[model samples]
Target: MKRARLAWAIAGTLLFAALAVAAEEGKPKEKRKGPRLNPIAETMLRIDRIKAAVEGLDLNQEQQDKLAAIRDGFEAKRQAIQDKIGDLLTDEQRRIGQEKLEELKQGGALGREAYQKLEEALKLTDEQKQKMEPLGKELQELVGATLKQVMQVLTPEQREKVQQKLGMGKKGGKKGEKKKEQ
Candidate 1:
């Protein structure tokens, strides 16, 4: 039950993000004039958006149960990778990481500043970042797949509700932008 709850929270984060990336696949990429957003910062924003979108829905018991079941297979793998990454951190770094992670979990509005704050707090050694990179990447892929499965459990109407909350409609544009243009 605890695992399921955790999965649901994680699903709230990753699902819409995966769908959004999937939605943007064919568009010509736009280059920004300034420094680009870090992938971690972009992900954190997506997590907030997706989590809120899912929370706004009226999900049923069956949907909840299905999400829990889907999460069971992925949780252990995710945790193991997390543990392995934790093993690489120094004691002090781990302490700071825990504190920062908790603060982020509590929903403070850091924006892209969240990444900068973490980077400053950790002062992660090059060697540590090098070792954790692959594990981090693998964790991301696993979570993305888990999120996709969670979305599959939703009915089309429920899915649309989530997308709309994320400012994404059936055609993958901002929720009402197309209608406004037409």
Candidate 2:
């Protein structure tokens, strides 16, 4: 009777161990969340926002075509700059940049001097800085042009709404102040 009980206990223990292993193996792995958008994904999301804002504004086909063209052109320029920057970054720099980007995504503010901090942190070479400067300027130009084109596509009322939505209007005044007022 003692041997039978021992055998049964051993069998039960083995079964329980197998069940625990199976349960662990069958469990779903948690998905990792990263940056809200990669560079290219960000450009596409921006374009989508423009589209959503302009919807129901009764734009003619030609104006819509122009907007599409402008978006596509800007996206290409943005992608090229992103690729260039990615190429220039070392693996370690990329890791740091990604962490910074994630922080920005999480509603963290980067101060005006953030670029200098980034430069120091990345230890960017003069040659890399030179290459980055023009690309940065080009990106700024593309953004301005894209905004102009989007505004042109919108009516006066829609433009105001867009400005407000983009936090360029009075309602967007001094981030914390707006929240406080509300």
Candidate 3:
């Protein structure tokens, strides 16, 4: 009887492990993070990429000075926004924040039109666009992968607690969703 019970326990453990591997395989990819770039910042980055890609299009001293000035001004404005958010946002600000973020990404105030203007002003080219797109994509993927790896080092129970705190652990999902395999 003891031997039979041991066999059942081993089988249960194996099944649990198999379920974990299956769930990991089924998991969707996560979004990446970096220096949180606004639409304007992203547009500026694309412009810089184009300038770097085109040979002999390097900025002269005056143009370089102007670019530096523009970047400094943008940085100052960003800092001010961060400072203002503390006084402006209330306890019920998360929904509004999400809406505003979506609006910005959409056509709220800074979207395709702004991108177009920057592209034209910077004389962006197809080759530069191709190069920059891949770089940005790769950077995002790298960040995601790094996050996954760090999370993997945590025990299943530890991961569950962290995810729950972060409000990401799903409810009523698969039984093994938060359970650690043997």
Candidate 4:
């Protein structure tokens, strides 16, 4: 009788453990957090950073006025690019963009390569590329102009410090590393 009770107790404990494991398995997984910022938001954040960095340069009144104008132009160009992208997207395209953005957030080279392959396969028409190219160029020009104007306002020593702050030099920054790899 004693042996039988002991066996029953052991069996009950084992069954309880199994049920606990099963219960855990049946629960839904927690969802991952989405991207913190979209592309436009990221660009704006960079612009803000540039503005902050320029504030430390101690520009003269004329240079300050020019920098302000450059910043204004940059903002306007950024908005135009945003509007153009929005106008170009259809519902289906927006869905695809969301999926791509999620994939990017996941941080896998395979995902990026797959996206590149998809773009190559699609082979956008010449007309479409032509239409998009100017918007891209305009955005780049605005950003570059802003940077140039800011650099103009700074002394050589200050410029060097700013570049260091931006991680722009040859001490194994992202661009430098990429160039080395190539």
The estimated TM-scores of all candidates read 0.62, 0.45, 0.24, 0.44
Number of the top lDDT candidate: 1
Task: For candidate 4, list the clashing residue pairs, or say none.
Answer: none
CA lDDT, every prediction? 0.56, 0.49, 0.36, 0.47
Regions more than 4 Å wrong, model 1:
1-37, 99-111, 167-182
- The digit string of per-residue lDDT tens for model 1 on 1-182 reads 98978655443333222222222233354453332343433444654666577767788999878866775677577557656755776788667755765666576624445455555566656666656556655655775676577678888888877666755547544324533212
Model 2: residues with Cα > 4 Å off, grouped in runs: 1-73, 103-120, 163-182
Model 4 TM-score (2 dp): 0.44
Question: For model 3, how does the per-residue alpha-carbon lDDT over 87-170 read when each residue is reduced to its tens digit?
Answer: 333444324433433443355433233333222333323443333343334333433343344335444654455455433335
> What lDDT score is found at residue 65 in candidate 3?
62
User: Would you give me the overall lDDT of model 4?
Assistant: 0.47
| Candidate 1 Cα deviation (angstroms), residue 155 | 1.0
Ranking by lDDT: 1, 2, 4, 3
lDDT string for model 4 (1-182, tens) is: 97976544333222211111222222343342332322222333345456667777767788778877876676566656655644554566445544543454355422224334223333334454445545544554566667777777667877876666554554323343323111
lDDT for predicted candidate 1 compared with the true structure: 0.56
The digit string of per-residue lDDT tens for model 2 on 83-113 reads 6656766788666755554444355433222
- How many clashes (backbone N, Cα, C below 3 Å) per candidate? 0, 0, 0, 0
Winner on lDDT (3 vs 4): 4
Name every residue pair that clashes in candidate 3. none
Among all candidates shown, the one with the greatest TM-score: 1
Q: 1 or 4, which is superior by TM-score? A: 1
Flag the better candidate by lDDT, 1 or 3.
1
